[model samples]
Target chain A: MRERFITLTSPVVPLERDNVDTDQIIPARFLKATSREGFGDKLFHDWRYDSAGCPRPDFVLNDPTHRGTILAAGKNFGCGSSREHAAWAIRGAGFRAVLSPRFADIFRENALNNGLLPVQLPAPFLERVFTVTRERPEAAVTVDLERQEVRFEGETAPFDIPPYRKRCLLQGFDDIDYLLSIRDKIILFEKQHAL
Target chain B: MNTLFDKIWDAHVVEALPGDTHVLYIDRQYIHEVTSPQAFEGLRRRGVPLFRPGQVTAIPDHNIPTLCQHLPVADPLSRAQLDTLERNCVAHDISLFRIGTPHHGIVHVAGPESGLTLPGMTIVCGDSHTSTHGALGCVAFGIGTSEVEMALATQCILQPKPRPARVRVEGRLPAGTCAKDLILHVISRIGTAGGTGYFVEFAGTAIRALSLEARMTVCNMSIEMGARGGMIAPDDATFDYLRDRPFAPRGAAWERAIERWRALPSDDDARFDAEFTFDAGEIAPMITYGTNPATGIPVTATIPPAADPQALAYMGLHAGEPLVGKRVDHVFVGSCTNGRLEDLRAFASLVKGKRRAPGVTAWIVPGSQEVERRAIAEGVRDTLEAAGFVLRQPGCSACLAMNEDKVPPGKYCVATSNRNFEGRQGPGARTFLAGPLVAAAAAVTGEIRDPRELM
Candidate 1:
């Protein structure tokens, strides 16, 4: 399973809010589905629509201008409730990376394990991306997992990514994958302990 | 240094594998309906019966409705999941406490209360709030579904031992401040995620002064700080709480267990990877402004400026905005965190005569049927109902927005739950995390307020 990691190809959409919790990312009503599909359609189900099921045109994602494979959000994204489904919906929705100032620890772990890149960019950098995404509808953003840098069209600075998480994402490695990489060591230790 | 983490880590390590992880045997495995479904499926696929069925205990809490015991589950998926758990437990010969059973409650609440949690045990559940059991001086943490399967198969997990932190709270907690407030204050001071990759040992006078129920509340939020777990040394209070618990030993066995528990405290000179101290009196009733638990201040104070560049940019809140008197559309007072009988008594004490603010929807859900029964017997439920609040059946209602209970979008809710992260109550619903009393006060005023004045 240790193979070349696939780079994210979907366009990024920016949701500029801090403390975006699991419930908001995917409401409880959506959890009724056992399969992890159909979640993409319900991402931000209540926020993007009104009570009558009409789109809330005022929301950023509801606006046509901000469409992309990456979502550049405000700091502390995925802040409340440790539901892995939040990460599932984000990944299932075809988003490659979620850029924020920080993330709730559980959400970060969930995102990484589920093959979603939750990038921790500085506040100014995140703000710049948000502005650029809002300003240029066609602008493309690139996140190089190998280099651990995020680059956007006409952007002057490259944001930093934690080296360890970057390595995992770049290799498409989850905790189990990382552990399995050293299977021989585990066998050896098990043998020694058994004796 | 021989910190609690090192001692526990050393004791539990079956062997150190080459991948910077240690193979540690889990002493106790707690299962709930939500996460156990996939794990049971994995077991079926692997053709593995539970390796040590006796070590596992399953409970149906999150998805089961509280009040309707004999009625079918309202949600099809929740019912299927609960049914799957019941079937799986029976197939594997593992113990289960189905809803309406005396042992049933939120798994975290039920585990320690039933004496399934004890000092020196390594406990893991598929739910994040599993850290609540750390209050029993154990190494408890949450695991994913896949990891849960691995534990059921081998009764062992590959884990990287965490560094240890000793958080000491000294001085008397002023009247009306509680263990919930103390933990929230600790999160605020240290910042959420400060204890990441660390096991926390909560000590000092303030922690000792708290009851076992209160200590569970503090440890329950340890996960919010990204810690593996939190613990307090076992004392008389711990023994007393465990004395006649269903699963606890009785007669001479109880005395023997107490003898062992008494020696579970860390040595006076024991060192920690990190240490922090706080004056309990300095903490007041706290409420979260931003999406994270750490973004908190006294209810009387204004929301602090999102001065932390990251916090400000994310929260969209200007500094010095008063959190007090901010209008709230809903008030939710339940969760594994603070949905106990004691919490209800506190909330009822504040809302006894006053009516729930007009136009505000308040949900009062007990953590368990036992809690519900206790509250009803104590007249707490009557007081709440008389005040126009609806007492909902048990389960983790509106805490994670998993069940039918949820706040409408853009509405503000004062919640006694552990988290105030953005949209915790519902989509775009702002949640102000507070204690039960503060939630009661908010229910009355229809805004964030201190319960002291209301009483």
Candidate 2:
């Protein structure tokens, strides 16, 4: 049921904060579900809503002018717990990609597994994007996974992802399918190497 | 030429693909209710039985109420999750450490204590603190739900080899400081993103001198620094800790296992992609002043002027202000990070005859039922109770506040659990991460007094 990632061009939703941990993306209290859907409503739950359940105007997500499929964030994005729900919440919120100067290791993997591109751009380029998005909320950014580049404001920058992961994302291939196909090799490896 | 990480990693390779990706075999997988339900559902969707059920162990830690072992869970959703896990394990033939059982606890804590986690193995759990097993010298890290399902389907996951980094802490730790202080200091020096994209190996004399439990505390928070995982080379101390654990090898098998583990350390000439060295003697009892663990300082020091203003605003702290006398409303002394029997003993020693400060609530939770039982047998519970600190049953209590042990909004808590991120404990709770001694000092003093002063 996952979408095959190829390319996305959309206005950027700017969250100018560093170390946006998974706990903030989706708080621990919301992790009670057995399924992967519907986390979008609770995405950034504490920050999106006040205790009275009203949308906080100061939060970027509440800004009606800035709406996009690509989430642009500051350095060290998704830097805490390895909850895949963070990716689920992002995808559930309709974000197809997250662009940052850097990303936490586990979150990067989780994002990729969920077909949400984690675009790691140069620090200066990311800063330029943030500035552009801040000045013009409707500015669109283009991300091309096939080309491994992000383009915005007359500037284009290349990003890097492991080639294997890129293949998985492009084909919508799940690791579980590949792993299931190679059960014999795994059993052979286990038998040959006894712990 | 092989580092310890390379040795453990290379040994687990089922197949090496292009771009340094390996189909790495997982020797053990720890499961909990919070993260495993979806993974189990994934298996059901695919119509696959667990590939190696014996290698997986399921436990319910997160969302389980620490109080009332005999009672049904009050939260219907939480209870359903727990029931689903039991049903999945029963259907799949995976082992379940049921609640109220002696072995039931946090996966990271119970995994090592039961000897299911061994050196030179590749381990994982759905939880981030799976890195805690790396204290026993494994290539353990947290995985997402998809990866969890992949591991369950074949006991193998495709991963790119992480570049290795070494953090060497030399000299001796100062008195009153523990492994928590050393790690907090490391994070402060390196910043939260310092370890991103690397597997960090904690080395040098200070790390070596730590007891195994203390080493677990250090490795438990590797994820906080954005590292894939943190590991310490298994030494005699590690061997000693695992020797007689319930599931560890016996007699000749134990001897053989130790021999293999002894050879698991990095060669003298092995090279790491990044290296850092710090003096352990200079580290004081450390505490976080901001929402991130990296925003830490020695208890007696003033907050840095360069501290993130937004984080400062969230924490209700000002730059250049000393944290030594800040009032704390609660003290939580438990988590996979510092919730072992050793941690409780350290806490009990600090407040043996003293009383908890009035209006300051303290929850002293152990990491596991076994830890709780040992604390009681060792009289650590009595000391904690005598100090007016209630000894709570083991779960991830108040660490994530999933079980109603939340600190009220805007309350300041000095916590031994890892993470000071906003709303980690509750929606508006402010957490100051610290060691057990520091938590004890805060519990008794009702403020952020240095543990050294109390000592």
| TM-score of every candidate | 0.83, 0.99
lDDT of 1 by residue, B54-122 (tens): 889998777666456688887778877778888989999999987877777788877887888877678
Index of the highest-DockQ prediction: 2
Q: Clashing pairs in model 2? A: none
Candidate 2 lDDT for residue B200: 93
Q: Write down the C-alpha DockQ for each prediction.
A: 0.20, 0.86
- Stretches of candidate 1 off by over 4 Å are A1-18, A46-77, A95-103, A117-195, B17-19, B250-260, B305-329, B353-360, B377-392, B409-412, B444-448
How big is the positional error of residue B408 in model 2, measured in Å on the Cα after superposition?
1.0
Name the docking class for model 1: incorrect
- lDDT, candidate 2, residue B94? 92
Fraction of native contacts (fnat) of each candidate: 0.16, 0.86
